[model samples]
Target: MSDAAELGAFLKARRAALDPADLGLPPGISHRRVKGLRREELAQLAGISVDYYTRLEQGRAKNVSDAILDALARALRLDPGEESYLHNLAAPKRREKPAPRRVRPELQQLLDAIQAPAFVFGRYLDVLAWNALGGAVAFAFAELEERNIAKLSFLGDRGKELYPEWDAVSREVVANLRTEGGKHPGDPEFARLVDELSRGSAEFRALWAEHAVREKAQGWKVLRNPVVGELRLRYETLRLPDDPDQGLVVYHAEPGSESERALGLLASWIAADERPVNTRSPHPHAG
Candidate 1:
């Protein structure tokens, strides 16, 4: 969608979600035609002309002032994230497709060195690189066809099983994807991902229509690992400043907890499997 269309759709969706009683407006006797606040009522509350508000909703308004956007956000009862998303939709910046992601050798080494599960994610949440533990403990990096977190969360069932708090995590993933979508408006790959997911998953379609935005960051997750049973893990995401679109996410279990013990067992098992075999004969005289 064009920026104007996106802006208009977002305005309409937010307006439709509000209730007159919730906003302390009297429930009138007349049957209302619109679902929520009428355009004129919203304009009156926002201290703007009805015609101006109409034009804004109809994608005809240009050079929208911050004052108006702020007022509308207030009138619509938007949260900080929602307000920021609204602003982005109103004034979008075009972004070129990012170059193909390549994990530096040093960064790959860093992932290998970490005792905990760690992986690198590119702009679209593609699993660019991961250590053995990351692949074993979390979702299988090599198993995924697209290696995209959003796809796994919505289009597949792996995320539902992996994350105990699946609903919240799925929403966050969608919101993060939405934020990325706003940042790169006409990106073909991004648009294709959205289209594919929207068609493949009803949940994705519903959430995508809401126009939520969020930045992916550190969070705790309860994972149901087939080998380890249930484990509570804290994850931290560190963005590469040199390449802002790339981030390294590491998952750690709390020290001395059952989860930590499970991780230790996993580490031991992996180490044993990777141990080199002694090939040379000991001595000619040895029995």
Candidate 2:
């Protein structure tokens, strides 16, 4: 449950998930004993001694300097998001307590100003807030438990129906959640979410076992909008510089495209619908 154990488990799990072929390692003749890369292979790729890597995995060594962390990150071919997770795992504890639950005020302003479908999410992919257009685009929000992205993506029955490419989105969500779990294995909320989803959705359980991890950035999604039928929108995860742990997810479409037209239609629908009273308290970081 300690941070070090969480970091070690994440590294090991990610390493085990990688196929030798994925990393350009030769496929040995004998049937592989482990699922992913072995300790020796990972050590070779990382330019570290196998003994050292083993110690790190065992959580027996506490000398994880920046150099070693960087080396391991590169060996795994981690993207910027995963690399950030690695650094956060190794960071020293702060003296002050972390902020309580809620979206920051500045983030709220940023979300409100955007005309496109957009929402802010916490480190755990919890929906902090969404703009009017964003809410309109995802009407499934009403059925979702607290508008948590992970919960909606996995547990919400309407979620699968709402997404055009339900299976692919489910896998991606589970993969990202797995990645977060590795980085913060001891996080109570993370554990609770994983447990809830795993029990609720068979699809989530299968994807979780695949050991996939993905950065939540720009991607395309075909959403089945109740107002406009189906719209293929491009979504981007905008990382917040000051907060570091939160990001604004903005969805847009190419000009004059069907997607754009659909978005406009959704906007009109939102304007017509009765506005729900905002009950969410202000997040501490809200400036």
Candidate 3:
């Protein structure tokens, strides 16, 4: 979608996500046609004219001021991430960045040194690199059609089994993608991926339409690994200052717990293989 269209769609989605009663709004009409706040109600709340808000919703308003954006944001109760996404949509055309072609030797070493499963993700959520444990614990990476986290979560055959908490995990993936989509509105890769996923799964289409924006920095995941049974692991994202486009995600279990012992056994099973896993890519970019 064009920036104007995306801006309008985002506004509509957010407006629909709100509750009228939450803001002390009465049921003004017995046969109210719209969900959430009506156009007049939102305009009144934002201190804007109803006609102007209508224009904004229709993508007819141009050169949208920060003041207006701020007012709408407040009225909609947008969080920091959503507000930023709104701003980005209004002022689209942020430049596309080139992805790194190869992980640094030091970076690859860092992943290998980690005791637990670890992997690096590119800007578009492609699996750029993964340690041996990551390979064993998470997926058979090389054999997969696409190394993208979004595709893996939604489109892959094993996605549901891999993530026992499928709904939450899948939403997280979509939210993270939405956050990226907001920042780099001009990115073709982002558009292509969204189109593919939306076409493939009705769930993906529904979640993508939510316009939820989030940066998943840290979280707990219950992964059902085939080798070691269920792994209740806590994952942390380490953003590289030198390369902001790439990040290392490490997943570890609590010390001395059954999950931890299972991880140890998993690691041992990984080490037992005479052939070392291919943890680094000659060409780092996935697409």
Candidate 4:
């Protein structure tokens, strides 16, 4: 399918997956004809005409003002990440600005200095670079033949083992991708990745249908550390000051905690088994 057509399908599908109750709409009967908020319902929430919203979803709307876009975003109850995605879709020209070549060197150096595990990632969640500790915490990076997170989550058995909550992780991954895909509808690489995963995994198909989006800013992670059994670590996502698309994702554990010891052991194991690689080497950057 054409890129624009594919994007339209993706946006529509995601919109359909959201329930009216999610947006605080009164509970409609289960026998309602549609699964999610109806087109008119969404229009009412956005304080726009149904015709206008329909045109946008149909990929026929033009000159979508920022105010209108913001209204739509608010009506959709989009998170900051998802709201950005919506704006990108309305104005495809913005994404033409290339992401910066290197994340600030200071940022990279800082990530390296952190004794704990950390990695800096671009907007697409491309793995620009990571410290030795970072590699140790998420062992899947070393094992990844491709660095793209979506591909790994859906296509590889290793991801299943690495992500303790595989189902939840997969859903978030798909949702995030849905937001990205909406923003860069014409991005060939993004389309190709989605097609490859959709064709390869049924689990992907189901989650893709749910149409959720998330910013991978900060969260708790439970990983099956190959070296340290299982460790539950808290990760904070720090957005680089200059690079909006790139951020340092650092993992840490509470002090005097077993997870902390496991992290140290995992670091030692990485030091022993894997050579420290460049932060910019060709690796799939998946968020």
**How well is each residue in 72-154 modelled by candidate 4, as lDDT tens digits?**
77776667887776666667454466555455567767877889888876645556677777866675455554666677677
| lDDT of model 3, residue 47 | 98
- lDDT for each candidate structure: 0.80, 0.74, 0.84, 0.70
> Clashes in model 4: which pairs?
125-285, 126-285, 127-285, 129-279, 147-284, 148-284, 149-286, 175-212
RMSD of 1: 8.5
Off by over 4 Å in 1: 19-36, 95-99, 275-287
What digit string (tens of lDDT, one per residue) describes model 1 on residues 1-287?
A: 66787888888888988888888787662487878888888898999999999988888888798999999999999888678777877774666756456777788789887878888877677778888788778776655446788887887788898888988888889988886666556677777888899999999999888776777778888888888789899989888988877888999989899999998887777677765422111112112
> Which segments of model 4 are wrong by more than 4 Å?
1-30, 92-107, 140-145, 180-185, 268-287
What total of clashing residue pairs does each candidate reach? 0, 3, 0, 8
Question: Relative to the unseen true structure, what is the C-alpha lDDT of residue 73 in candidate 3, on a scale of 0 to 100?
Answer: 98
Top candidate when judged by TM-score against the true structure: 3
- TM-score, per-candidate, Cα-based: 0.82, 0.80, 0.92, 0.81
Q: Superposing every Cα of model 4 onto the true structure, what RMSD results?
A: 3.7
As for candidate 1, its clashing pairs are: none
lDDT, candidate 3, 110-174, per-residue tens? 88898889988877888888888887888667455568888888875678989899899889999
Alpha-carbon deviation at 39 in model 2, angstroms:
1.6
